[model samples]
Target: KQDSVVEDISAGCGVINFKVNRKLLVQEDVKFGLTSELFNTLKRGTTLVEYSSPNIAKKFHAGHLRSTIIGNFIANLKQSLGNNVIRMNYLGDWGMQFGLLGAGFGQFGCQEKLKQNPLQHLFEVYVQVNKEAEHNEDMKQAARDFFRQLEQHESEAVSLWQQFREITVDEYQHIYKRLGVHFDIYSGESFHQDQAQEVVQQLQSQGLLKTSEKGTGVVDLSPAGDMSSVCTVLRSDGTTLYITRDLAAAIDRKAKYHFDEMIYVTDKSQENHFHQLFHILLAMGHSWADRCKHVPFGLVRGMKTRSGEVVFLEDVLDEARARMLHNMSQSKTTKEMDNTEDTAEKVGISALIVQDFKGPLLSDYTFDWDRMLQAQGDTGVFLQYTHARLCRSVLLKITKLYLAGGVSIFALCDLYSYDEVLYQSAQDLQPKHLVNFLLKLCHLIASAHRELPVKGSSQVVAQVGRLILVDSLAFNIQLYTVPLCTKHKLI
Candidate 1:
């Protein structure tokens, strides 16, 4: 066994490293998390991850899906290495749009439509109501009045919007559960509505807020915006801006959680907005301002069916599972070997996640089904196939033994045999290197298992040895299944 380099150094009083010379016992089916080796190397800190924020009554798109998975991976990694992690889902359940949804659902929204196609049908009604209001000033007043009613605690408007939001959340929860994701906080812009006013007061008191030429409250980001396009904090009608909501949200989270740091994950277009947000907080004297981060991803073209073509996140999962099922059906593998539907979801989702994470986060990517499912190359299929092979091999292992003194290298009547090439190849390879190797080894193992024979070893010893080998192989395959961090600290 090799000791990590840090094992010999004794520098800090609170922590000390010492070494013991002993056999390195292998644990069965163990998943690595917060190992002493990891904690020793990791610098201490806290982190916040904000992701998977689909707006109220809006279709959950690929971008939101991406944020959900990526932010999750980051939070998982940070927490695994002993950092305080805050997972925030900034749901977009607010704004004048809710007003439109409430108004439309009141008039022409159908019960069946709301049940079967909630987000889309509601969105349809919302778009129509907005268009109608834009052309018919009376419709505009109605929409405004609808929003005001909701704002002023009007029972009917509030009740409908609440139902819409609840149904949307429940539906999304089902989808997220299927996808193996969860959020710690569902902090929305609406949740910060009251906090936004206080933030405004703080800004006003700190002299960060100003009355712009247009009568809306502005944040004096003029110098920050490079002499043009200053940022807005409040509309002329006194409604808070999106950035204002974010400022209040950050403040609320920090005050409540006392996080060591926080991260906001969104697209690049919001870069300027988050910058102004952090600056406003810094001006308000939150020293943790330095800890806030906005992780931006690139544009995804053709994001809607109405826009000629688009990719839905659910569609992506469906395609991946379908393709996986098709491949399994074509394979000579028995149904007993793999569940077509269950394995389909696992393998499909793994493929999706692997593809999304293969490239740098800030880079744009084209979605291609074939590219993601290729079995002969780097892919989730390849990875899963590798895992399955390890499982089978562990289950298939046979122990070899010899008579007390008669066993020879090759002269025995029954000699345990291994593919010379495969055995030789596995020498310098670590466990991870074995996954793809297992793919190639499948045929070899199948043939070898049939042809090879055990020698004079008793069945008990042989069974025990074989079981131990299987456990070793399973442990190794598990190591491959774990995701690596951006810094490659662990896998």
Candidate 2:
């Protein structure tokens, strides 16, 4: 029997290799540019992705890095598959922590220090107040009073909280710009605080709200219904808890966006929180809760600098850029490029993204600057290097081939596997598959570049070589255009 797709099948060394018809592969590549077919196969719909929800009045920590990049990748992937994506940053703006900060500011804050360095000043105030509150009864009462004033919408307390929020957001925008990340909405726990009361009322009306002996509002979640597993919704003081606000936010989002799906990206520590959230939503008769998902990732241990453990995300970014610049300076092939700092920054970010994405999302990994910044091996620096080398060596020839209306059969074979990886990535919501695929493609293209020299080849052979290079370049360009690689600035 003859196969149209598989040109030849041979067995070797405990493996069977099936060689695809190159001409057909090139024809497909020419017709669809490697991903159009897969994109067409997907069902387009609106997707709401909530991620990078850092608390206000605090520095963006390295722990948030995983959520930021992972959520960005999911949004980018969904959008690439023709889904309408809403990127949301659900900020932690309202909480008891704010109460302490507010009281601390009143006692020990400096306006000049705040103006000079907002996050650092706010952080110091928070730390100092927490330490004092440990032994000082007056400090504890002050924090409670300040929080009560905020809850009551007192003008003075409201004004101070708003200023802190504004300053934090302004500073965060600058850092987000550096990371190439953005959000369509900057919502916070405060946004749904009022709605949370309505949620409690609904829970009461539905007979789902139960009062514990301690007078806190909770929902029984255990199978035995013996109050073994409970989800708390309100405090004894009647203030809404985190889950209460989350329920309100979910209901509000469904009414507003009518999305086909919603994804929450957070650390694995909050797995039970989201679990109870969705379960309670289902119990509340919001069937749309079925479409909601929680994508949890593991921690990045040892994410620190020589100075100390990293508290601010800016510190990590600066460290990566500085380390990358130093490494570049040591390289003999390093040439002066325009915006060298910008290039280094982008590449350093790529290193961070790739290191985070190269393994299973639920598996914690240690961060090593020396390992990730290496110019060789399975690092992002190597990925960028490959792209640069291909661009410098064969971009002009690839352009000529494109103008001639010819597709590269030489590289189509390597690209054929991309669609499978992409489809798997979308289905599983895992980026490791895509990362590994790109790394393998880089190795294959590098090998092809070495073996297939175009400088002295026949016209047909040279055209084939150029086409191969162009396919790789085109694939990379398409990748970077998407938010995933775009954030990394791989091109």
Top model number, TM-score:
2
* Candidate 1 wrongly placed segments (more than 4 Å): 1-46, 222-229, 301-312, 333-338, 396-473, 479-491
Encode model 2's per-residue lDDT on 1-491: one tens digit a residue. Answer: 34987889998899887766767767666442445665676644899999999987665665688898899899988988889999999999998988999999988999899878888888889989999999999999999999999989999999999988888888888888888888999999999989999999999999999999999999999989889999999999999999999999999999998899999999999999999999999999999999999999988888888799887888899999999999999999887888889889988998888888999999989999999999988888888888777765466544545434344444436566666677878888999988888778778767766777655567876656566565556566446436465556565
Shift in Å, residue 263, candidate 1: 1.5
**Per-residue lDDT of candidate 1, residues 1-491 (tens digit):** 33742234454779764432211211121221334553444433767789889887665577887787777766755665467777888889888888777776667689899899677777778777767777787666777888888778789888888888888777777777767777777778888887888888888888777787789887766666443655688889988878888888888888788887787777777788888888778878987988887878775544332233433456556667888788777777534644568877777776776666655577778766667776646666666665565455444454333234221222211112122212321222112232334334434433433544232345765544444443444454464334222221111
Cα-based lDDT at residue 233, candidate 2:
98
Q: List the residue pairs that clash in candidate 2.
A: none
lDDT for model 1: 0.64
Q: Score residue 84 of candidate 2 by CA lDDT.
A: 96
lDDT of each: 0.64, 0.84
